[model samples]
Target: METTQPSGTTKRRVELRITRPTLTWFARPTVTIDGVGHPAQWGTGTWAVPDEGGTRIGVYLYNRVWRFGTATRTVTAADVSLVYRSGPLPVGAGRLDAA
Candidate 1:
């Protein structure tokens, strides 16, 4: 469900598909929308964001040692579906693509 902002505007949401080659993760993933961090799980999730253009979406996995599998994308008003694929290795950045 969409949330109502203090200004009474319904917050926009986007569908995020998160996946990694590994079976498990020590810590949950984080979805950062416009710099705000939201905890997320694997598979599919819906995240609330501002209802405006030029929104930046970022996803990353945080292990106990360090944060990796990072990716970022700038979405427009009509953009919604997104998929974040973690890199095979834990050191480099991942891929974020429109789905």
Candidate 2:
């Protein structure tokens, strides 16, 4: 899916980083921009405008233990880096936390 912004809207790049707790299992990270999922094998860098409400960004971490589960969060800034943690449970638990 493609997202279009209004004219004169300023766009900036934001970096999203996903990390796993020590001793945790493997996790596949995916970034959701305005509700659209984008598979991020390494990390995600995307353009967004803070004023535009369509700039809701999230990071989801999927693992074998938490099947069908993902940790999601919203980002609303530019030139900023957001971090999320993934694990079996008690860590993340399908919720994103700022690091």
Candidate 3:
């Protein structure tokens, strides 16, 4: 969906679907867009897109001791759907792709 921001600039949104295996130990996922952090839960979530194209997105699971299962991607489509799938091992990079 798209909405107008207070600055009169039009902003868009992208749907983010996140999932992980059973061994995350209750650590939450953080979705970072354009260097800003946003707390995310499992399943579907939405993030506001400040720019329509060339938006940077990153996802990682923080277990307090280490930050792993990290993924990053750049989006250029007007309507986009992203998914983050954690790796089997917690110390590896996660899969992030368009869905």
Candidate 4:
């Protein structure tokens, strides 16, 4: 990602799209030098993403774990719009403003 610069701030802006997916299963940390997947429990971690064998990844910092894998999830402003459009849980009739 390029740092924002005054000269081309608007032109080179990255449309960062973030989609808050459903809370996934608690992932157990694992490691595989070769092509294998192992499950780590409670307090273990390795560099691996959700998928892609070995590419994209998410670092579980608070949990104190870091992983590396190939599974890049792109989020966009539009996506956020869609998610909120449905409104917060407890199921509403879908509104821009909900009390």
Best lDDT goes to which candidate?
Answer: 3
Best-to-worst lDDT order? 3, 1, 2, 4
lDDT of 2 by residue, 1-99 (tens): 468767767656666666654544576667777787777765444445455443666666667766333665555543366666655553545555544
Residue clash pairs of candidate 2: none
Worst 10 residues of 3 by lDDT: 1-10
**lDDT per residue as tens, model 1, 1-99:** 556457546488889999864633574689998788888888998876778888899998897878988899998888889999987667778888999
lDDT of 4 by residue, 64-86 (tens): 34332222223232222111122
TM values, all candidates: 0.84, 0.56, 0.85, 0.21
- Pairing residues by index, what is the TM-score of model 1? 0.84
Q: CA RMSD for every model?
A: 4.1, 4.5, 4.4, 14.8
lDDT, candidate 3, residue 36? 77
TM-score of 4: 0.21
Candidate 1 colliding pairs: none
Error of 3 at 45 (Å): 0.9
For 1-99, candidate 3 gives per-residue lDDT tens digits of 555458636467899999866788767899998787888889998887866588899999997788889899988875479999998777788988998
Native-vs-model 1 lDDT?
A: 0.82
Clashing residue pairs found in predicted model 3: none
Query: How many clashing pairs per prediction, in order?
Result: 0, 0, 0, 13
Question: Which candidate model has the greater TM-score, 1 or 4?
Answer: 1
